[model samples]
Target: MKVGVVTFPGSLDDVDAARAARLAGHDAVSLWHGDHDLKGVDAVVLPGGFSYGDYLRCGAISRFAPVMSEVLTAAQGGMPVLGICNGFQILCESHLLPGALIRNDHRKFGCLDQRVRVENTSTPWTSSYAQGQELTIVLKNGEGAYVADEVTLDRLEGEGRVVVRYVGNPNGSLRDIAGVTNERGNVVGLMPHPEHAVEDLTGPGTDGIGFFTSLLESAATA
Candidate 1:
C-alpha cells in the first residue's frame, strides 16, 4: 500500500509519518500542501505541526491549502485518512470530521504519554485494535480539547462515532473524547501522535504501529 504524508509549511512530523508508514510495510509518499494531486496514494495522513504558524487558528489556514481539495474529495470517496494532533485540527477545519479542537481548558500546552481507549475498531485506521483496548501514545498540542454541540455529541455517542477516549481528562474535552471517525469509518482524527510510538526505542512502545498496520489489513480484507 502507498500512504501519502502531507507536508504543509511549518509541518514538523511529515518525516516521522513517512518513516512510520515505511516501517508498517507501505510505500510512503511525501505530498506537498501546494499540490492538488494525490499521486495515486491508497491512503493519506495529515501529520502534526503548526501549519502557517497557526495564525488564523490551529488548522484554519491549512484547510485552504491546495492539496486539501483532493484530500477532501478522496476522503469523501472512502479513501482512508488519518489526522494526528494538528492534523486532527485540520480535519475538523476541513469538515471531513465533526467537532472542533479548542484550547486546553487549563490554557496550557500539554505533552505527555497519554492513555487512550480504542472505542471503535471498525475504521480503517483502527482495525488492528480490539474494542476497548487501552494504549499509551504521545500527546502534545496547545489546542487539543475536542468540543461539539450537545446534539452532535449525542449523535456521535449513539452512533459509535467516538473512536478513542482519554483514560483521564487531560485536555478537558467533551466526554473525554480523544478521537472520532466519520459515519463511513474511512476518515479518523486523533490528537495523539501514533507515529511517534511506532518504534520502541523512540516511544513508549510499538503499539502505534497498529494505526498504519490496520489500514493495510483493512485494505487486504476489502
Candidate 2:
C-alpha cells in the first residue's frame, strides 16, 4: 500500500508519519501542501504541526492549501484519510469532520501519555483496534480541546461517530472525545500523535502501529 503524508510549511511530524507508514509495510509518499495531486497514494495522512505557524487559528490557513482539494474529494470517494493533532484542526477547518478544536480548557498547552478508548473499530484507520479497547498514546498540543454544540454532540454520540474518547478529561472535551470519524467512516481525526508511538525503541510504545496496520489491512481487503 502507498500512504501519502502531507507536509505543510510548518508541519513537524510528516517525516515521522511517513516512517510509521513504512514500518507498517507501506510505501510512504511525501506530499506537499501546494501539490495538486495525491501521487496515486492509496491512503493519506495529515500529520501534526503548527501549520502556517498557527497564525490564523491552528489549521485555518492550511485548509485552503491546494492539496486539500484533492484530499477532500478523495476522502469523499472512500479513500481513507487520517488526521492527527494540527491535522485534526485542518480537517475541522476544511469541514471534512465536524466540530472544532480550541485551546485547552486550562488555557495551556498539554503534553502527556493519553489513554483513549476505541469507540468505533469499523473505520479503515481503526480496524485493528477492538471496540472499547483502551490504548495509551502521546498527546501534545496547544489547542487540543474538542468542542461542539449540544445537538451535534448528542448526535455524534447517538450515531457512534465518536471514534475515540479520552480515558480522563485531558482537554475538557465534551464527553472527553479524543477522536471522531466522518459519517462514511473513511475519514478520521484525532488529537493524539499515533505516529510518535509506532517505534518501541524510541517512542512511548508500539501501540500506535495498529493505526497504520489497520489501513493496510483495509486496503488489501478492499
Candidate 3:
C-alpha cells in the first residue's frame, strides 16, 4: 500500500513519517498541503509540526489547507488516516475527531519520551498491537492537553474510541487520553510521535514501528 504524508508550511515530521511508512514496507508518497489531490494513496498521515506557525491555534490555520479538504473527505469514506501531535490538533479542528488540544497545564512546551498504553487495538492504526501494550515515544508540543465536554468524553469512553492513554499523564490531558479514533475506527489522532520512534539508531527505540505495520496489514486485508 502507498501512504501519503502531508507537508504543511511548518510541518517538521512529514519526512520522518514518510520514511517510517517506507520502512514498514509501504510506498511513501509526498503530499503537499496546497494540493487538492491525494495522489491516489491508500492511506494518509498528518505529521507533527507548528503548522502555519500555530498563529490562532496549533492547527487552526492548517485545517483549512486544500489537502486537508481532500483528507477529510477521504477519511469520511473510510480511507485510513493517522494524525500525530499538531496533526491531531488539525483533526479536531476539522471535526474529523472530537475534542480540542489546549495549552499544557504547566504553561510551557514539553519535550520528552512519554509512556503511553494502547487502550484499543481495534483501530486501523493500532491493530498490530495488543491491548494494554505500553510504548515510549517522543512527545513535543506546547498545546497537547486534550479537552472535551464530559458527555462527549463519556461517549468516547463508552464506545471504546479512546485508543490510547498516557501511563503517567504528562500533559494533563483529560482522563490521560493520549490518542483517539473515529467512530469507524479508520481515523486515529494521537499526541505522540510514533514515526520518530520507529528507528532505534535515532529514536528511543523501535516500539513505534507497529503503527505503520498495523496500517500496512489493514490495507492488505482491505
Candidate 4:
C-alpha cells in the first residue's frame, strides 16, 4: 500500500510517520498541507504536530488546509484515514470525527509511553490487535484531553466506536478514551503517537505495527 503522511508548516513527525509506514511494508508518500491532491496513496495519516503553530486552537486552522479537502472527500468515500495527536484535533475540527481535544487537566505538557487497551478490534486501524490487548504507545502533548457530550459519548460506547481506552486516564479524557473510529470504521482519531512505537530499536516495543499493517489488510478486502 502507498500511504501518504501530510506535512504542515509546523509538522515535526511527518518523517517519522513516513518511516513507520515503510517499516510496515508500505510505500510512504509525502503530502503537503497546501497541496490539493492525495498523490494516489492508498491510505492517509495526519501525523502528530502543532500544525499552524497550534494558533487559535490545536488543528483549528489546519481543518481548512487545502490538502484536508482531498482527505475529507477520500475519507467520506471509505478510505482509511488515521489521525494522531494534533492530527486528532484536526479530524475533530474538520468534522470527520466527533468530539474535541482540549488542554490536559494537569495543565502541563506530558510525554510518556502510555498504556492503552484496544477496545475495538473491528476498525481498519485495530484489526491486527487482539480484543482487549494493551499497547504501550508514545504520547506527548499539552492539549490532549478528548471531550464530547454525554449523549455522543454514550453513542460511541454503545456503537463500539471507541477504539482504544487509556489505562490510567493520564490526560483526563472522558471515559478514559484514547482513540475512536468513525461509524463506518474507516476513519480513526487517536491522541497517542502510535507511529513512534513501531520500531523496537527506537521505541518501547513493536506494538504499534498492528495499526499500519491493519490498513493493508483492510484495503485488500475493501
lDDT of each: 0.96, 0.94, 0.94, 0.94
TM-score (C-alpha) between model 2 and the true structure: 0.98
Candidate 3 lDDT tens digits, 53-159: 99998899998999999999999999999999999999999999999999999999999999999999987799899999999999998999999999999999999
TM-score of each: 0.99, 0.98, 0.98, 0.98
Could you give candidate 4's per-residue lDDT for residues 130-213 as a string of tens digits? Answer: 999999999999999999999999999999999999999998999999999999999999998989899889998988889999
Please count the clashing residue pairs in each candidate, in the order shown: 0, 0, 0, 0
Top candidate (TM-score): 1
Candidate 4 residue runs with Cα over 4 Å from true position: none
> How well is each residue in 10-66 modelled by candidate 2, as lDDT tens digits?
999999999999999999999999999999999999999999999989999999999
lDDT for model 2 comes to: 0.94
* Collision pairs in model 3: none
Alpha carbon lDDT at 124, candidate 2:
93
Q: Model 2 — which ten-residue stretch has the worst lDDT?
A: 213-222
Which lDDT tens digits does candidate 1 get at residues 85-161? 99999999999999999999999999999999999999999999999999999999889999999999999999999
